[model samples]
Target chain A: MIAILSGGVGAARFALGMRQIIDPTEISIISNVGDDEVLHGLHISPDIDTVTYTLGNAINPDTGWGLKNETWHAMDALTDYGGITWFRLGDRDLATHLFRTQLLSEGKTLTQVTDRIRKRWKVQPRILPVTDDELRTVLYSVIDGRAQQLTFQEYFVRYAHKPAVSRVIYEHSAEARMTPSVIQALENAEAIVIAPSNPILSIGPILAVPGVSEILSRRRERVVAISPIVAGQAVKGPAAKLMAELGLRQSAYGVAEYYKDIISAIVIDDTDAGLADQIRLLGIKTFPTNTLMTSPETSKNLASAALSMISGEPV
Target chain B: MIAILSGGVGAARFALGMRQIIDPTEISIISNVGDDEVLHGLHISPDIDTVTYTLGNAINPDTGWGLKNETWHAMDALTDYGGITWFRLGDRDLATHLFRTQLLSEGKTLTQVTDRIRKRWKVQPRILPVTDDELRTVLYSVIDGRAQQLTFQEYFVRYAHKPAVSRVIYEHSAEARMTPSVIQALENAEAIVIAPSNPILSIGPILAVPGVSEILSRRRERVVAISPIVAGQAVKGPAAKLMAELGLRQSAYGVAEYYKDIISAIVIDDTDAGLADQIRLLGIKTFPTNTLMTSPETSKNLASAALSMISGEPV
Candidate 1:
């Protein structure tokens, strides 16, 4: 079994690429859950839905999120009622939340709901939430010159992640235990691949789970990470800005340092060749290649490289 | 002031005609609530939405319900999750339910939500539900040689109102009180009109509220009703089938008898002009004209005749 740690768009895209190189049936994706929130009384898990939609070939290629040919009729009507429309819920996407909310209210766990959704999408990989319990990412941002804590959506959607964030913390991560399937997937994996997602915002919360980081630390030799921040900038989203604001290195070297304790090798872009020595000095192997996944071939090649790196194949 | 005791489609269409003769702002429609039901955890008041959408010019003319140019993406997706898709919910229409559900959860009454929704639609008619409390229409039907009780939607939508209904009852009608607006609108009205909706299915529930029938009975001289039946046939819906099943008068004369106690006059169609003298024998005046609202002119003419009948104008 091949286990993958994933977030939203980047993670989903990477998994799509990885599918090109391996049997999707052999993959178990442990998706981030810190971005989950209840909107309009409907339970929404952004990461899980993104991965599920992406793998099922239902994702909107334009936005890299939501469903293809989706309509925003509900949202357009919502604006007339003075409802918050920042998060951008599409017409078709509302079904996932409605089904999930109904099932969860009927005493089904989030895990069961996720399974039902994936089954409907016919997604091949086993998509497991990091935890079924409540765990959220809260950011302390300076708004109107006063530091106030905001939920992940508020920071990311409402404020457009423009406000200066003083700190980022995970809520309930300390007490939340990883799901049994996730633990088993980790234990039985031939290799664990960390997807090229936002290291701090996306991947950080997964590591904060009580036993997740420890498990990866123990199996460090088989853990490989693809750096999202390449050439000091993220290919998409706010990784570089967030890292710079959080007072961390904004280069591939910074990404390697973030996962150094729990990873055997770090894949940097060809542009980040100058940072190889620095990452190597931190006691982690570096794989330099054309990591910019502009096409399916690149992403699949990246997946092949991860596999080769795990099997001790020559670079 | 003109007060209309209303239900769905027929009532909304009647109100549209009435608007052609009078200022919409001067009209107050007290709608039936016995058909209201919760589906997918969303509070849906079909009658209220119909009247609201109709007056706002946003209604689908072909279907006689829902918004114009609406998308069914949410509902189509819902079918994949094994949800009940028989009660079609369009994408834009889901916003109304979502807003209503959220506002109701936040302690806003159904009246408040209705006002908010109408205001957004820019509807001028003061559409008020008969009561804010829980009230539903339940039908007893014989299916597969067994007597079964079903909600109004099940009888109307799921079964296409096909099952032989033995009886119809209203839930919580005795305990439910009319909203303050409805009571005040009724007490101060110059004329009260029972729209040409399904009398047993629509107008029956409105009058079923504990004090509503008594209030109108006391003001019997000022009240007028339009017959849904004309020449032993209903203009639309299951009214004809239901009236026949319930063993009520299946003609305009029968309609006159149904409202004989509280209404001063009943408007029948030109086709049913032969039954006027027989209706007058029941101590009610009969206004026979072209009541087939096939065009805006016919609906407007019917509305004008109803107004003239109230004022002793030449019929």
Candidate 2:
């Protein structure tokens, strides 16, 4: 089985490409639930849904989120009914939320509902949330010199991530217990791949869950990570800004350093060829390739490159 | 103050007409909630929404349900996801459900949420549900001689009410308490006008609520019911078939007999003029006019006619 540590768009795209190249059922995605939040009483799992929709070919390609050809009727009506429409939910997307909310209200755990929804979407990959417990990624922003933590969505969506970040905190990371399926995937995997996702917002919170980093550290030889930063810029999201804010060099080398202790190899973009030797000096093997997945074919190439590296083959 | 017992299209149109002639704030609409159901986990109150949309002039004039110029992207995507899509929830309609579901999850009562929603729509009428409790109207039918109790939507929307209903049961009627506002409206109303809605499925369930009929009975002199049946047939729904199944004449006189104990006046269609004297024999005054409300103006005229009858004036 192939285990993938995912964030959102980038990882989801890579996973989708991997499904095209490999038997979809052979893949198991351990998605970050840290971005989960209750929006208008529905459990909104950004990473999980992104991965599910991307793999199922249901994602809105233009937005890189939500369902394809989505209608904003619900959001329009919601606005008319005095509801907050900043975080827009498409009608079809609302159905997923509605089903999830109902299932959760009926006492089903997040894992159970996720499985049911995935089944309904006919997704082949065994998508598992890192944990069922509440694990919120809180952004501590300094607005006018007053520090306050905001929910991930509030900072990302409501404020458009314009808030100056002082620090980021994962509220339930310390208390969350990893699901047995996730632990088993990590333990039994022949190879582990971390997709080119936002390291701070996406991958950071996933690793913050107590046992996750420890497990990767123990299985370093099987773990490989693809750099999200290509030519000193993030493919998507606030990864670069967040890395610079956290006092780190905004380069592929910075990403290598971040995962050095837990990964056997780092896949950087061919554009950053000079940094390959420097990254190799950290005792992690370096694979240089076109890591910018601008299309489905490129995404598959990236996944294949990472898989080959994990199998002790040069790509 | 005027109180209207409403159902769907015809009732919504009638209510809209009344709003045009009366100070909307002086009118209270006690809508039928028996058609409410949890679809894909979202609580859908169809009758309540129809009334709200019609009064706010947002209802689709073509279908007489949902929002005007609404898209079906959500339903289309839902069908793609292999979800049930027989009960078409337009994109804008989905928004109402999403907002309502969110508010309900946050512990807001249906009444409070409805008020907030109406305020957003800028509707002037006090739209109140018959009760806050669960009151489902189930139609008992036999397919090949096997009995089953189908939900109101299942019978109405899914089957289009083709199967002959052997009986009708107002589930939770015994336990339902009249909404305080509805009871107050009944107690203090200068006039109570029952819209020309399906008498069995619409007004029947409303009166079945424990204290509602009792209140109407006590103030019978102030209550007036417009006949859904005209020329021996119902304007809409299974009222005619249901009446026949229940062993009653499918005529305006049948409606007068159905509501005779709790109503002082019966308004019939001009086509049913011959039944006026026969309906009056049931101890209720009869007013024959063009009760078929085809447009907003007609709805207002019908409302005025009912109001006039209650005031001891010719309509």
Candidate 3:
């Protein structure tokens, strides 16, 4: 089994690519729950849904999230009642949240609800939330000279990720234990691949889970990470901006440094090949290739290279 | 104030007519809470939304409920997940439920949520729920010689009211108290109008509230009920079937007999004029008219006739 530490859009795109080259049954995605939010009484797991929709081939290519050809009648109608809709939910996409919320209300765990949704979409790859407990990525930022704590969606979506975040804390991570499925996947996998998602907002929360990082560290020889940053910038989202704001280097080198403790190798874009020597100096193998997954072909190639590097094969 | 005891579709149409003939400010609609249901974790007050949409001229003309040109993408998408969708909710109409649920979670009463929605639609006149408490209309039905308890929505929407109901129960009505606004409206109104809705399922739940029936009895001289049953059949819904199933006469006279204790007069269809004498024999004044509200004009005419009867004027 090839387990993937995943987040939203970027990771979903990578999973779409990985499934093309390998039997989808071999993939196990342990998704980040730090970005989970309850809006209008409906539980929304942004990262989980992104992976589900992408793998199901129902994702909107334009937004890289939500359903394709989605209508905004529900969100547009919210304006009629002056309801909070900055975190817009599409009409067709609402069914997923509704199904999830309904099942959760009936006492099903997040992992169970996710599996139900995955099967509904005919997705073969196993998708599990990292932890069933409450694990939220909370960011503290200084706006107008006052410290404000923002939920992941509030920071990334509502605020457009503009606020200079001083700290990113994974709320409830101390008490949040890794789900048995996730632990088993990590323990039994031939290799673990960290998908190129926002490092702080996505992978950071997973690492914060008490036993998750320890497991990764013990199995570091088989772990490989795909850096979201290429040529000193993130391919998408606020990874680049947020990294600089939080005092981390906004480059491929920063990504390698961040995961050096638990990763045997890192995949950086060909454009960032100049940092290969620097990354290798940290005792981590560096595989520089065309990592910008502008198409399915490119994504599949990147996944192949990452897997090859972990198995000590020529990339 | 001219208070109206209300339910869904039929009551909304009557309210629309009342608004046309009188200053909307003079109208106070006390809506039934018996059919208020929570679906997909969203609080859905079917009757309240019907009246609000009708008064705002946004109701679907063909169905008498839901918003006009409403999209069903959300409900259609639910089927993909095998989600329970026997109770279909339109995409645009879902905004009301989402808004109501969010506000209710924030500690607002159903009455407050209804008012917020009313203002959003620019609807005039006060629309108050009979009670903010849990007063569900539960139907005890025998299906294949087995007794089953069904919620109002389950019996009405899910089962299509096919099961023969043995008894109708207003769950928690014994402990439910009428809202102060409803009581005040009844106390201050010059006359009260019971709309042409299902008596057992609609108005029955409102009267089940402890103080509500007492207030109507005290104002019996000024209270009038518009029979939902016309020509020995209901204009819409399962009123006739349920009435007969519950051992009621299932006619205009039966409607009058049902409310005889708390009502002074009733407006029945001209086709049921033969039963007028029998209704009067029961000491309830009867007014015969064309009460089939096929159009807005007909509804307005019916509203005018009912008001004239209360004022002792010729219809």
Candidate 4:
């Protein structure tokens, strides 16, 4: 079985491509929980939901998040009731949150709740949260001349990621250990693929989980990473902005360096070919190709390329 | 303030009539909370919502509950996800639950959360829950020749009120005292009205709150009840059937007897006129008229008659 480390939209799209190369049932996704939050008293795991919706063919193509054909009656009603509604929860999407919240309140772990959602969606990919315990990314940012700390949702959704983030702290990650299932998936995987996601916000928290770094370190030679950065920019989201703000390089070389200790190979975009030698200097094998996953066919090609890099087809 | 004891649809309809006679701002409704239940991990107070939505003119006139122009996207989606969708929660109605749940989770009392919902609806009536504490009405029923207990929502919504109920339990009602506002409204009311709600299921729970019965007893002379049953038939809901199952007389005289000590007068329907003398024998004055609240005019007339029966003008 192949294992993947994931964030939200970018990772979900990459997973879609990967599933095309291998059977969806053969893939296990370890999703970031730092962006998980409680909104309107409902537990929302954005990253896990993204992966589920994408795999289930229910995701809204325009937003790359939430469900398609979603209605906003609930949010509109909540808005009229003077409820805080900066985080837009579609009516169709709310069912997932409500069910998740119900299961969590009934003392089920996030992993169990996620499994229920995945099965309901008829998604074959095994999506597991990196940590079952609460682990949130808190962003310290300056918005409208006011310096404040905001939850990942508040920073990402409420402000539309407009504020200049000074720092990001992953709460509870240090104390949160990998779930047994996730640990087993990592241990049994023939190859590991780190999806092209926001490094600091998405993959950072997943790596920060206690013992996750050590596990990846042991399986370093079998791991590969696809750069979220293409040239000097992110194909989607605020990955480049957040990486630059957090005092990290916002290029393919930077991505390779970040995953250097955990990955033996890195897939850089065709535009970042000049950075191949630099990425190789980090003691990582560089594969320069059209990494921009815009269409299903192109994404499948990219997935195949990444898969072939693994020894013995990593079946 | 004119205080009214309420249940759900029937009581809301009666209150709709009362508001036509008196300014809605002058009315205080002490709604029963025994029907309250947590569905999908969201707190749902059906009685309180009915009153709030009806008074706010946001209620779907056809359903007698939920908001006008509401959508069922969330419930539909929840159904697709295999979550329980028996208690149909409309999309617009979900906002109330979400907001209430959030406030309650934030350590706010149900009263405070209810006030927020009321104000957001721009409703002028003082809608107060009988008690802020948990008071759920559980039904012990024999469905399909099997004996089992269920929540009020399950018995009502899930079972469609079809089960033969052996008993009705008001959980935690004995420990629940009236909220301060409800107590004050009761103490200062010109007239206390018992809306034409189900006696065994609706008004029964309100009367079960620890100190509420005593307060009504102290003001017995000014207490007036509008019989939900007219000519041994309920205008709405399972009042008649439940009363018969629970061993109470399913007639207006039964209603007068039900409130004998706390209510000095009762407004029965013209159809129940033949039972007036029997009701009078129960030490209660009877006001027989066209008490079927088929129209706003009839309901207002009924309200006016009940207001006039308060010993003094008590307007």
Candidate 5:
């Protein structure tokens, strides 16, 4: 079994490529829930939904999230009431939130609800949230000389990730324990892949959960990380910008430094070959390759290379 | 000021007629909350929406409820997850539930949410729920030779009102208190109307709230009811069937008898003129008129006639 630590769009795209080289049934995706939010009384797990929609082949290609051919009637109608429409929940995508929220209210765990949803979408991989307990990624930033604390979405979406964040904290993570499913996935996997997602915003929440980082650190040899940074820039989203704001070098070397303690190998884009030796100096094996993943074939090749580093097998 | 005790479709239609004679701002509608339900984590007030839609001219003319050009995309998508779609929520209608649920979760009362919703619909009348507390109408019925207890929506919508009801009870009416707005509307209105809605299922719930029936009975001379029945049957719905099952005479006379204690006068259809003397014998003045309300003009004339009984003015 192969386990992937995932975030949202970037991770979903990486999972799409992972599917090409492995049987989906053999994959287990332990997803981050720090970005999950309650808007309009609906529990929305953005990362989990992104993974589900992308794996189900229902994702909007333009947005890299939400459903293709989705309608905004519900959101549009909400505008008449002067309701909060900044979150952008589409009509078709609302069914998932409704189903999840209703089931959760009926005393079902997030894990059980996610299982039902993925099966309904005909998605083969097992997708488990890192923890069922509340864990919000809160950002501390000073915008216009006034210090403010914002939810991850507020910093990323509402503020368009423009504010310089001083620190990011996972709220309630101190009391959060890994769900049994997630723990079992981490323990039973033959190999683990830290998908190319935002380090602080996505994977940071997963590592914050009690015992998660310890387990990864102990089994470092079986773990490999694909850097989100390619050629000194993030392929999408604010990974590079957030890293820079947080005082980390915004390059492949920086991604390697972030996961160096929990991973034995790191995959960097070929354009950043100059940084490979510097990353290796941190006691992490750096494999420089074409990690841009602009298409299905490129994504697959990237996944194969990352797997090969740990497996020592020719694909 | 004029106040109307209301239910769903029939009451909404009557309200439309009332709007034609009085300035909408001068009208106050005290609506029943017995039929309110929580479905898919959404707080749905079917009667409130019906009144708002009907008065705003956005109601589906064919069904007498829901939006005029509603789409069912959200409900359809729910089917993919084997989620409950029995209640038939439309995409456009979902915004109301979402808005209400969010506000209520934020500690706002149902009365406050309803006020906001009505204003958003451009509805001018003051629509207030009979009570902000939980008050569910539960029906005791014998269906397929088995006795069962059913919610108002379950009996009326899910089962299509086919079960023979032995009795009906307001589940939480004992603990329910009338909202201040409802009490004020009843006390300050020049005339109070009991709309042409099902007495046992619709109006019954409103009266069940504490102090509601007492206020109407104290001011009996100012309160008049428009009988939903014409001749020997209800204008719409299973009002006659339910009344017969509950052992009441299935006629306009039965309606007067049911409300005789609180109502001083009643307006029945011209077809039921023969029952007038019998209803009047019970000490309730009966006015026979063309109460079919087949069109806007007819509805307006019926409202004018009902208003004239107490006001003694040519409306």
Candidate 6:
């Protein structure tokens, strides 16, 4: 079995590429559920849904989130009712939330509902959330010199992540237990690939869960991370800015340092070839290649390169 | 001000007609909520939604319940997830449920959610549910020689009302308090018109509420009921069968008897003119006219005739 540690967009793209080369059923993905939040009485796991939609070929290509050909009628109606419409949930996407909420209300665990939904959508890969427990990423920001914590969605969607970050806390991580599927995937994996996702906001919370980082550390020889940052810029999201805010250099070398003890190797973009030597100096092997996945072909190339590096093959 | 006792299709048609002649804001409709049920954790008030959609011109002209041009993506997805899909909730209708469910979860009363949703749909008429509290219509039926009480939707939609109904009970009528808006409409109305709706399934449950019948009886002079049954047959639904099963004659005279003490006048179809004299003997004036509202013009004509009759004008 091939296991992948995934966040959102970049991770979903890499998984889709990997699915093309192998039997989708042979691949297992441990998705980040740290960004999960209860919004408007609905449980929304942003990363989990992104990976599910991407793998199922149901994602809106233009927006990279939500369902294809989604309607905004519900959101329009919500706005008319004086509801906060900052987090735009398309009508079709709302259906997913409604279904999930119903299942949750009926006492189904998040993992069970996710499995059922993915199976219904015909997604063959076993996409398990890192845990079924609550592990919210709380952002502590200084607004007018008063430190307050906000849910990840409130900081990211409501404020567009514009607030000055003072600290980031992963609430409930100490109590969260890795799900059986997650542990099983790790125990049986032939190779483990970490997708090019936001290191701090996405991957950081995943590693924070007790036993998850320890599991990766014990299996370090088989684990490889594809760097989200190239040179001094992030491929997407606020990864680079977040790295600098958290007192880390905003470069591929910073990414290598972040995963040094947990992963065996780091994949860097060819544009950051100079940093590959520096990344290797951190006691991790480095594979420098064109890692920017601009299209399906580029995504496949990246996935193939990561897999080859894990098998001791030169890409 | 006009107070309309509404059910669903026929009542919606009459309300549509009345809207053309009166300021919609001046109209108050006390809709039957006996049909409401918690389906998949959604509080779906069908009769209220039908009336609201009809008044807003968003109702499906063909199906007569949901919004026009509605997609069934939610229902389709629900079935794909192994959820019960016997009752069809269109995608647009699902939005209504989602908003209402969220509001209810946030501790808002049903009346508050109804007002918010109706206003958003741009429905001007005050569409008040008969009660904010639970008042479900349970249909007791004999299927395969066994008696069982089914929820209104189970009887109406799932079984298609196939089994012979033995008893119809309005559970919670003893506990349900008439909403303030409904009481105000009854007290302030210049004329009260009971739409041509099923006497047992629709109007029966409204009168079953603790103090509603007493209020209507006190205001009998202004209260009028248009017969749902005409010429020993119902225009739609199981009214005829239910009336027969209840050991009442399936005619307009039976409707007059059903509303004997609370109504001052009964409007009977011209086809049922033979029952006019019989109905008049029940201490209620009878007006014979064409009550079948097949078209908007016919509906408008029926509304005018009923209003003129209640106003003591020649019909």
- List the candidate 4 regions with Cα displacement exceeding 4 Å: A144-147, A312-315, B144-146, B313-315
Q: Tell me the DockQ of each model, to 2 decimals.
A: 0.50, 0.38, 0.74, 0.69, 0.73, 0.28
Candidate No. with top TM-score: 5
Each candidate's lDDT (Cα)? Answer: 0.87, 0.86, 0.91, 0.89, 0.91, 0.85
lDDT of 1 by residue, B213-300 (tens): 8989987777889999877988887888888788887888777788889898888898998998998888888898988888788878
Candidate closer to the true structure by DockQ (higher is better), 4 or 6: 4
Write down the lDDT that model 6 would get.
Answer: 0.85
- A238-277 per-residue lDDT for model 2 (tens digits): 8888888888789999999989889989899999888988
Q: After superposition, which runs of candidate 3 have C-alpha atoms over 4 Å from their true positions?
A: A144-146, A312-315, B144-146, B311-315
lDDT of 3 by residue, B64-179 (tens): 78999999999999988899899889999999999999999999998899999999888998899999999999999877788899999999889988898889999999999888
B1-315 per-residue lDDT for model 5 (tens digits):
899999999888888899999998999999999999998888999999999999888999999878989988899899988888878888889999999998999999999999999998889999999999999999998888888999999998899988889899999999999998999999888889999999999999999998989999998888899999987888999999999999999998999999989999999999999988899898888889998878988889888988887854322
B41-116, model 4: which lDDT tens digit per residue?
A: 7899999999999878888988888888888999988998788888889998999999898889889999999998
> If the candidates were sorted by their TM-score against the true structure, best first, what order would they fall in?
5, 4, 3, 6, 1, 2
Which of the two, 1 or 3, has more TM-score? 3
**Best-fitting candidate, scored by DockQ:** 3
For model 4, residues A1-315, the per-residue Cα lDDT tens digits are 889999999888888899988878989999999999887778899999999999999999999998898889989888887887888899999999998988888899999999999999899989999989879899998777888999988888888888888898898877898999899988889988999998888999999898888988998877899999997899988888888888888888888888889998988888898998888788888888999888998888888778677776443
Q: What tens digits encode model 6's per-residue C-alpha lDDT throughout A1-315?
A: 789998998899999888877789989989888888766667788888898998889998887888898777767666666765788887667667767877888899888989988887899999888888889898888766778898878887787777878688889999998899899898778778888998878888888888888988998888899999987898887788878888888998998898989888888999988887777788888888988888888888888888777764321
- Regions of model 5 farther than 4 Å from truth: A143-146, A312-315, B142-147, B312-315
A1-315 per-residue lDDT for model 1 (tens digits): 889999999888888888887789989999899989877777889889999999999999898889998889999989989976888899989999888887887888888999999999999999989888889999988899887998888888889888877789999999888999999999889889999998887899999999999999998888999999878999888888898889989999989988989998988898998899989998888888888877888888888877667864222
Clashing pairs in model 3?
none
Per-residue lDDT tens digits for candidate 2, residues B33-83, read 888988766778899888888888788988888889888877776675555
**What is the C-alpha lDDT profile of model 5 across A1-315, one tens digit per residue?**
889999998788788889899999989999999999998788999999999999999999999889999999999999898887878889989999999998999999999999999998899999999999999999999988999999988888888899988899999999998999999999878788999999889999999999999989988888999999988789998999889989999998999899889999998888998998898898888888988877888889888988887864321
